[model samples]
Every structure is written in structure tokens, then in C-alpha cells.
Target: MAGPQETESTQITTEAPAKPATPEPKKKAARSRRAKAEATQPAVSKRSRQSPKAAEAPAPATRAPRKTYSEKERAHKLSQIEKTIVGGATIKNAVGQAGISEQTYYQWKKAAAPASESDDLKDLLALEEENKRLKKMLAEHLRKENAELKNKLGLA
Candidate 1:
């Protein structure tokens, strides 16, 4: 009696799992149809090319629409994305949370950074140049003062 009940419960659970599994076959069927369509396409195209009257119009390209973001918006999204990544979230999760696709995230990451990063680099370079100039001037002034003092003391 116990063995039959255990088997029955397993059978019920198996049925429940099977329901989800059923959808995969439908997906595979759809993919097979697509494959068949693609497989036949080249043959048809080749034949059409040989026949002057069978010119087929080109298929329209399918692409996701481009979204334009302002500099502030892009910076905000990038910061949020970076925070999520630093918090140990995967890139897929971070981008999903930011409501942007992986493609968009990668595109933004690859392209030039927002103006802030470049501006900081420029400022650092300018400060380095100014520091060099000031150091040279201070050294020259000290050398001149030292010469004058040595002449007064007859040391030079």
C-alpha cells in the first residue's frame, strides 16, 4: 500500500513537470520550420536569379529602434549600472534593472564616456603643467637670490 502511494505521488509530480516540458517541443517545431524556410531560401533565390522575370523584392531589415539619451540620463544609467555591478550583480541583471538591453549597455560602455571623465583628465593635465611652471620659477628666483647673497659676502 505504501509503495503504491509513493508511486502515485511521483506520477503526479511527473505530470506537473511534463506540462512545462511540453512547450519545448512546440518551440522546436517552430525552429524547425524556420530552418526549413531558410534552407529553401537560397535555392529559390538562385533559381530566381537565373530567371530574369522572377525578381524578388529584398526583405526588410528587422532591428530594434534606437533610443537617444541625454548626457545626464546616460550618466545616471551608467552610475546605476556600475553600482549594481559593484554590488556583485551580474551584467545581465544590472542591465535589466536599469531597464536597458545588454546591447545598449555595451554600446554605451564602448563609446566615449560622458563629458565629466574627459573634463577631469583635462583639468589634471592643466594642474600638472601649472605646477611644473611654478616650480621652475621658484627655483630660478632662489638661484638669483643665492647669487646676490654670495656676492655681498664675497663667496662667489
Candidate 2:
């Protein structure tokens, strides 16, 4: 019984794993079909010449050049839009009548603001920087004073 069991286990261990047979046949069949198809079909060049009808078709109409507004034109348009708005027309309607988009109108308005406003902003930014510098200086001075006091009190 022991001899038979050992022989059975050795046979099982020595046997090779069986591979699936269906996939290899399918791949070979596909390759043969593709080979037959390619042989029957004529090869085509990528850049074939256009047909007479396509060549004779008139070229598409060229687009008109885009109109660029100068500063004077932009300011005039912005003012016209504002006047219409002041006369109780909706901003959208005013901007449309002025031949400009609302976003463009806002951009022009922002750009046309008084220089004094920007000057004030610059001054405010300068003051904020000074404040930060002063704060840092004060903090460092306090830290040094604290250390000195600690030394005098024998806490360090």
C-alpha cells in the first residue's frame, strides 16, 4: 500500500501542467485570415491625388480681418455704455448697443479708473510692509530682553 501511494504521488508531481488549447487555435486562425485578406486587397498610397471635382471646387471664403479698438475708441464706447446705463437701460442692452461685450466694458472701465486710486493702493501696500518690518524688529527686541531678564533672575 505504501509503495503504491508513493508511486501515485511521484507520478502526480512529475506530470506537466496542461495548457489551454482553444486560445492558440483562435490566434492562428485570425493570423491566417488577416494574411489572406491582405493578399487579396491592393495597397493604397496615403497621399492620393484629389479628384477633378474636389480640385475644381472654389476655395473657402477668406475671413474678414478682426477690428482692433484704440484707447480713444475704447473710452468712447465705455462712456456711451455708461450713459445708456444712466438713462435706465440695462447694462447688457447698453453694452450691446455700444457694440461691445459687457466683459469688455468692465475691463475698459477698470482700466480707465483715476490714477489716484492706484496711488492710494501703492501707499497702503508700502505702509503694510513697514508695519511688518516694525513688528519683526519689536519681536526680536522683546525676545532679547526676555532672555536678559531670565539671566538676571537666575532662571537660566
Candidate 3:
């Protein structure tokens, strides 16, 4: 009877501590699960909230197509820009007034620079023409020589 009583008392003591420890671990697990659920819920809610706002927002404005300018128009714009500059305005303001970009203004200026040196360009053109004429004359002379050789050999 004593041995049985001791065994029962030990079992009761151990089970009492185990019951308390088990509840603590369960409580901690419940808290962690709640935290995970809370974290996931906010992210899902944020995505859902942003979707409607994105759909309701106006579409981004489309860019305009590029404009093409003729050579005469370009020349007129360049002159206008130059006159504005001569009147003490900056290049930016000058180009803007002429309805052209700074890059276009600079490009037109560079192209016009060569035209100012017409004498050099004219001389270059004349030299090229003379070279072509000489080449034609040389080709004709060679053909005549080839024909003379073929006639002497009686294979013309």
C-alpha cells in the first residue's frame, strides 16, 4: 500500500508541472501564428488597395511625334536665332524664339560654316572634273593600242 501511494504522488507531481509547461508552449505557438497571419494580411490588403487606385488613375500622356523642317525654314530659323543673339539674348532663348532646339541650332551653324568657304569647294570640284577627263582620255588611248596589236596579229 505504501509503495503504491508513493508512485501515485510522484506521478501527480510530474503531471502537474508538465501541464503548466505544455500550456506555455501552446500559448507561444498561438502568438507566433497570429503574428504570421497579421503580416500576410497587410501585404495582401495593400496589393488589393493599390490595384483599384492604379486602374482609376488617368493614363500617362503620350509624347508628340517629331517635327521635320525644310532647308529654307531651317535657314530662316537660324537667321532669327542669330538676330536674337545679336540683340543680347542668350542662345537658349534665341533658339526657343526661333522654335528650334539648341542641338538643331548648332547643327545648322556647323553645316552653314562650310558654305562660307565656297572658293575652296569650287576648286576641289574643278580638280575632280579634270581628273575624270584625264582618266577617260587614258582609257581611249589604251583601247586604240589594243586594237592595233590585234590587227597586226590578224586576230582583230
Candidate 4:
């Protein structure tokens, strides 16, 4: 028979009492395997020494550092390869001209090829143009949408 306001006030005051604080148990220190092994093993004196070479083995010599091509160099190399293709030169000739191995030339050529066996240059150029066009369209659309959003939010 209580009114709505009275019921609400009673519900608000009838929440569970606060929980009692509990004491935290202390943590035990951890012992490492290496520490246990050292403790179990017999100790050696500082005067007991081994030969320097026997104490530590020398590391094997590392291979020479690889050569990295600059962006200009890479572009020039690709251009030469493309020119060789346009000139109808053999892979050997192209490799010679580009100062790269035959394997490297073939690898680059294979990587550059499209799904079809047609000219890769045409495909690459078409892709580049398409990418440029798409980017331009996307930028314009984003600009318009951003302006609209700003106006809606009373930021303009």
C-alpha cells in the first residue's frame, strides 16, 4: 500500500551493509633452480684456473654485410630492366646491362609480371594511374563529409 515515492526511498535505503576488511597473508620468498644447484654443488677455489682458450671458445667469423641499394639506384635498375624488356633483349643481356645476376633479373621479372603474360609496364602504369585517381576521389569525398560533420556539430 506504500506510494511510489515512499517505495523508491525504502529501496534506496535497504542496500546490503559494507563488507569487513580481511588481513592479507604474507608471501614466501622464491628460490631459483640455479641458486639451489650452486648450494648443492662442491665449491672451487679462485686459484684453481683453466687455460684461457679452454675457458672460452672463440666465436665463428660472421659473413660480410649485405649491400643495400638506394631508392635512386633501385629505380634506375628497374628502369634498365624495363628498357631491356622493351628492347626485346634476352635475360642474360638484361642482367648484364643492369649489373645483376641472371637469377636476380629473372626473379625481378617474375615478381613484376601480372596474371597474364603480357607487358608488365602497361599493367604497372595502369595500376599507378588508377591508384592516383582513386586517391583523389577519396580525398574530395572525405573533405565534403568532414565539412558536413563539422556543420552538424556546430563547429563551423
Best by lDDT: 1
lDDT of 4: 0.74
21-127 in candidate 1: lDDT tens per residue?
44554434445877887876655557667775655565446676787898679778989999999999999999999989999998887664645688899999999
lDDT of model 2 at residue 52? 63
In model 2, the Cα lDDT at residue 138 comes to: 100
lDDT of 2 by residue, 30-115 (tens): 45877897877756444433566655766556666777899889878887887898999999999999877788888878887865
Question: How well is each residue in 39-88 modelled by candidate 4, as lDDT tens digits?
Answer: 88757555433556534755345566676766467557877877887899
lDDT, candidates in the order shown: 0.84, 0.81, 0.83, 0.74
C-alpha TM-scores of all predictions:
0.47, 0.34, 0.38, 0.28
Candidate 2 Cα misplacement greater than 4 A, ranges: 1-64, 114-156
lDDT of 2 at 123: 97
| Top candidate by TM-score | 1
How many angstroms is residue 114 displaced in model 1 relative to the true structure, after the best TM-score fit? 9.3
**Which residue pairs clash in candidate 4?**
none
lDDT per residue (tens digit) for residues 21-106 in model 3: 54444344445877886766635456755797766866557566898988788878888888899999999999988877899899
Off by over 4 Å in 4: 1-66, 109-156
